[model samples]
Target chain A: MAAVVEASRGERDNQDQELVQRALTRDPAAVAALVRRMAPVVHVRVARALSRRRVEARGRDLRADMEDMVQEVFAALFESDGRALRAWHPERGLSLENFVGLLAEREVVSILRSGRRNPWTEDPTLDTTLNELDTDQQSSAEGRVASRQRLDQLMDRLRERLSPLGLHYFRLLFVEERGVAEVAEETSSTTDALYAWRSRLGRLVKQLARELDDEEEVSDE
Target chain B: MSEDLPIRVAQRLREEDEALDPRLERLAMGALSPEALAELEADAARDPELARQVALFRPLSSELQDRLTEQMSAPVAKVIRPARWTRWGLPIVTLAAAALLLMTLRGPSALPSYAGRVEGGDVVLRGEPTPAAQGRRVMRGDSLLTLELSPATQVDGAVVARAYVRTPAGARAAPGVPEVDPSGAVRLRGVARELLGVASGTVSVALVVARPGALPEPDAAFAPSEGPRLEVQLLLR
Candidate 1:
């Protein structure tokens, strides 16, 4: 089974690399294909970006605005010999979809910020250090690996504190990443109740994080 | 401290622990201070468990984003209709309606009555409360002689008794402390203009007793039936 999965992954990587090369060469069909595949995800990401900033579309045509943002993302990806597309190293074993989604999200957020009538004047969701971590350029790969290990240990401790309901909530919300409405309908609960549960779960995780941090500082001293 | 978080988030968490929403929101938006994000990254880098937590919560940021996006994308139906009434016209129409209602409420025959015995000469309908007997000219707003009864009726095994008056308008309980003395006395004073109307009519006064296991509705007693009763004759010319 493992070998089959590995073989499939290899085939997908080859396909992705070929598409990327074709797109970089400015093949019209290749570019169109990429756009078709990326548009929905890009539109979703852009909408998410603006919302996190609390940018109100107000009475404006939001669909048009989203289309405009998606266009801009495509334009950037294909500009100047498709530098961004070439820069993406699928050999790094990262999901190419996630990389493109993140790129599109960042580009959309930048466009929204620079928009002439942009409602948001601040980057409310910007965490520059995490942003730096995302690039993985500011820290050694080994350091990131070690940090991830420490994070796992802390999570195990938190898991112990969570009740069955809490665990179920985390699984549904985070692990499954299902929509709140969908989850609420499935569980026979109100969306408001689901939001409340999520808020509570977040607090529990943050509290546990704080306690873990305190213990680490004590040990370091 | 809870106030620092979004109202929805604070609604579900303890005051001390309610900042998670803003923290996560800021984290997702990349809005946290460089120092704080760096510290968080360092912590995650050093702790594998924390890294897993970070991984778990990474999707939550997107979940929130998707939720907000979905909300924004929902189509809002705007209904545009022609104005039914002008701004000034609305108030005038309202005032006229209110005036008509007031007239209907305060017109003659809006008076209420109470249950009591009507002796032959007890109720006198004149222009005012007077010693006039039997028949008298009654107009709108004229007071009638008070109704007085003596041993109007007796019921067996009646634990409680309630008296109500039936008028042309409606039936209402007599306005006084319920007193069924050993002599069984109930009296009521009313105006003919209010109870009988300006157009000369008769009103019926009835008493109902609630027997054990058979409690009579006070309003139901006002309906003429087989029960303790007194017939009062009022001739308003």
Candidate 2:
């Protein structure tokens, strides 16, 4: 019985390692499996938080509503063809949770920007949205090999730090693709307030990644 | 930083990003300091997340290149927009003039988008014309012509061109901490051509005169220069 149990345990470890390897190779099947398993966690977290926001807004066009923002996040992540899913590279601090959080933060920022004009007094017409576009981002072939390795290591570290609650938030925001208003209405908060919370939570996730990077850096040194 | 870009290009990026839905242009010069560009390049190759971020920047860069090509297009200069007063006469004159050389706006409202060295002459494109009914006018010195834009007007080329304005950029924005901005000297650095690619055209003209408005100082976003006073032309899809 002991020998049989050992064999089973060894097999399980092998399976886990194989999954990790597949993910690193940017395999679509592996990526889809991972997304299916984790997307819901993101949805639940976003939904619960957004519900709180919906209650807070008595009725105001607050920019960066979580629910409104979440859908775009999933769409961008999953995209139409799903090319980006397989391309996800792990960085020192880019945990799956953190990656989702980064997407959330970026989405919110864009949302906030979409509605808000440049806040300059003198130049009311001054387009505040400067050159946000950086052209031609293809990396040189020379550095890609090392960069890919480093990125994979980073993703591994990032996935490990994701908490269940954080995972849920990602699923809510990324998978369910809920609007901030909808989330706020459910949670009894305003979209504006939800924006603040989303920002804060996203910040926390980044802090965790930073800590992870520090750990990795130390190990490397 | 990235490679050195033309002055018109720098100006356009400073002025237009989301407005002109552009494709990616791998920034070659000046947008990023060489060291920073190198550092980021290294990061991108190794970092998938970073790579994704880098990819996001492509469309914008491509737009810049396209704008430059449009700005420097000799072919466009040779073709002229037909004038309302005469049948084919206006276009032929403009095209003839342009094929010989790109019109130089002697006064303000000239093609101001070109960098390095540009000639002086004006192509007055004023008043509201019918949608897609192209017209061209020779620069009449002081009276800057305005191309009253019709929805979905795609006016390109010099002879067929209504007006050309190139606003030279000077100054720079603080590094990092992006803000919604157009005409940011810092961000633009030294753009050579800012092609105005307009989509779902509105009453806004693809090319317009800056009038007598004074440009801002080096520190100011709107500082004016004494040279040609053309604006960044808007191109339509």
Candidate 3:
């Protein structure tokens, strides 16, 4: 089993190297292959993050968003100067799983951070409105109730690790729903920094969302 | 050079991972160091998928860690208390709350209590909203029970969570998760996850409604999720 696993890793590395070359050559097939190879990893990570989302849906609508996040990452990664990925180093002990995991985390975090939220609350307005809707009703379905709870948990987790500055940044950028120019003016930071932090924090949130989801899953077990 | 931060983040992640539930333990790019974490993380690290996941998360300062502990609590967000109140809340309380987190109760679960039974079909939310009306009908498959909007309304996916006051006017829809404006009419926002899907099976949303009055009744102000909400209405149908 160990030998088989090792062989598979080796084989995969070879494939990746070839794919990188072809991608760099602007081969669309390589890009497609890269997505096919990596999409599931991102999906799994994203689903896990969204699971942390904690909102119960009659239908799993967020699944669509999760899939989009992963797909976007693959598209970006493969759209290089030559469609070849410059970031990967397969031989130095980088695993595709980790590579994709990192990407998903960053993506998920950015998605969460980008949403304009309620600054005083640190909760996104959209999400908050949804929760309020759930609570106001006279009777609710068990499933919907569960979804609401999960949403709450996911939000709590997002706010959990935020620093004062980070929180302030998030408030200005997301909660306060400020523009990049506005955020820069308020923080005395450049627009680039604000953009970069949003991305960074977004990645962090995505990671946390996945973790929160896993936490939910683990608890189920 | 930039990668070193991931290393520190990974170390902290490993620490966090040890305490995390299994599925969440190793999803980021940097996580439990195979060597540094508890036995569980060490074992999880051996898997390339998990290890790769550890690397994906963002790294922040320790200040965030301390803040996380505080942020996870609703009581903290709601108010600041003295040491005595804080002591009562307890870290253990929050830790224990992991089990209790994400308990969203939408619709009739909002009210304190009352009961009826449905003989056939199931309750469902159908139709659109009006100034006087919010959502309509309740269904479980072909069988349907129409629902008239009340106050304090909440919706989870399809399930409704709400509470009722004395008069029909007082009774409202479920509590919206994040809280909504009632100036016009009933509107909903998704919030807090209630039940979770176990990896093996589909986690479903089941709806219920209770029209309980009086705060002191046996059915009054329950967990908001304890009873079969649609049962009474179902019985009526």
The DockQ for candidate 3, computed on C-alphas, is 0.02
lDDT of 2 by residue, A1-221 (tens): 00011112223234334443453343433333333322333333333233222323323322223323444444444443433333333321233444555444343333333444211123322122111111223345324533333332333232344433333343344335567677666545678966665555455445544665688689899
Residue range B121-181, candidate 1, lDDT tens digits: 2223445333222233223334333333323122112233454555567766643223332
Give the TM-scores of the predictions, in the order they appear.
Answer: 0.27, 0.19, 0.28
Cα error of candidate 2 at position B180, Å:
46
Q: Show the lowest summed lDDT stretch of 10 residues, model 3 chain A.
A: A1-10
Task: Show where candidate 2 strays beyond 4 Å.
Answer: A1-32, A44-56, A59-69, A80-88, A116-221, B1-237
RMSD of 2: 27.6
Candidate 3 per-residue lDDT over residues A1-221, each given as its tens digit: 00001113445466567655654544433333344334445655565665444332223345344434554444444443422256655654445555555555555655555544211124344446566676776455645655444444444455446533564565455544579887787556788988998788667756765786787689899
Evaluated with TM-score, which candidate comes out highest?
3
TM-score of chain A of each: 0.49, 0.30, 0.46
lDDT of 1 by residue, A73-124 (tens): 6655655556666766655434455557666755664565454534333433
Model 2 C-alpha lDDT per residue in residues B54-162, reported as the tens digit of each score:
4333222222222222222223212222111112245445644763453253322232231111111222334544322222322222221221111111112221112
lDDT score of residue B20 within candidate 3: 40
Better of 1 and 2 by TM-score: 1
